[model samples]
Target: MAASACATGLRGSLVSSFHGTWGTSMMGEDYPALIQSVPRYVRVGPPVRSPPCMKNVNEGKGIFAPAVVVTRNIIGKKRFNQLRGKAIALHSQVITEFCKAIGADGKQRQGLIRLAKKNGERLGFLA
Candidate 1:
């Protein structure tokens, strides 16, 4: 049900009571054998529902190796001699700065955000 139309008052109390009674038995065994028990109904919330924030998320977080992104960058002009330094000239820095510029570091992605904000300024759709 939509948040505004959620069952309230009697319906909520009724549901709470119904579920409360099902979790126990006079013989001390869990009443519902499984979540799909005949009398127990499973209700999935609306598709747009947000789950509780979970931990250990990998994407959108910089909790990954720097090597994968920085190793490909060229440090200097070189056709014969390759002068490379991991700390001083690893390609990861370019990617890191680029990400920082766009605010992927999460403090603020203002550069791209500003560009996007002004996208319509020069367009025929300018407001």
Candidate 2:
């Protein structure tokens, strides 16, 4: 089982394959641009609403409707550490946009996420 047979791809044997050999381990060296060139971020929106159940949460001494927000990000360990600042900056931008749209005083962060306001306990706005 000479390694040359695998290199030439004539017999398609494991002896000459790239799967497990120190011959080309440097090929594993990750280049940021090369990795970034690959499309990574895949966004899948929430499923169709199936008559959402009413969940109660306590707020200000009263039970209020709860809105759930869940996000999943696929970032490798090194990339996670590297993108911390970028992630925070994007979050800050979103916060700024929300504040500008709602005309909030930018004091209460909790108040910003849930921007639902009631008008005479009948119709409401959630944005």
Candidate 3:
């Protein structure tokens, strides 16, 4: 009888200690209320979709479009445009002189330009 009473007392102390540490009843019916008392987090603004300055590299429509876009980004837009125009004019002049030296006609020069454009596209410059 004494051993049985001691066992009951030990079980009661364990239950009381558990209730004190957890701040809950023996059946845990207050768990939902405890969880509801916790603070919730909320976002302040809309989520980010993309970067602010995502320039489209496909805006330029030529065999050297990608190079032009990269150079434009490195240099200012105004300076890049000026340099691009001068380079294009120089390229045309050089091509015209080479065609004259080789006795090639306008049609042959145009075909060569088309071939270079095709090769550039295949190499993913148009991408």
Candidate 4:
């Protein structure tokens, strides 16, 4: 399904350039007169039609639901010291940024709101 969609987009774009050029050149005088003309529909290639299942869905803004996890492995048991200072510091930086945004007001807060909205319902902040 994904492959078909990609091929459709790429093929349409490739042929569209020729289609536009053909239309413009066809309007000019002193074009080759004896050229055997094929039907426009036949010569221009078949139209690209998406699968019926995707007709009502907007491909660009589709929603995704995250799966719930029931079990998680202990981080340090298998790989000792693998996730020590570096992991902690990375998490701390993320927490600090969240705290700053939470504490901010007006202009600063708007940036956070915009990010949340851009993420759509993924963050569960907006329905």
Q: What's the TM-score of each model vs. the native? A: 0.17, 0.25, 0.38, 0.20
Tens-digit per-residue lDDT, 1-127, candidate 2? 5788667786554354457556456546565557678776654687566897553232222222121111113445456545644755676678778778877785664464344323211221110
Q: Please give, for residues 45-74, the per-residue lDDT of candidate 3 as tens digits.
A: 898587687544444665666775687788
lDDT of 2 at 34: 71
Where does model 1 exceed 4 Å of error? 1-103
Question: Which stretches of model 2 miss by more than 4 angstroms?
Answer: 1-76, 110-127
**Reference-based TM-score, model 2:** 0.25
Between prediction 1 and prediction 2, the one with superior lDDT is: 2
lDDT of 1 by residue, 8-123 (tens): 55476665433334335443354445534655454567666678874323322342223322433334324112433343244445645787676586444445445533442333
Write down the TM-score for model 4: 0.20
Residue pairs in clash, model 2: 6-16
lDDT measured at residue 101 in model 3 versus the true structure, 0 to 100: 96
Evaluate residue 75 in candidate 3 and report its C-alpha lDDT on the 0 to 100 scale: 94
lDDT of each candidate versus the true structure: 0.42, 0.47, 0.69, 0.48
lDDT ranking, high to low: 3, 4, 2, 1
Candidate 4: tens digits of C-alpha lDDT, residues 21-40: 66667765435552445454
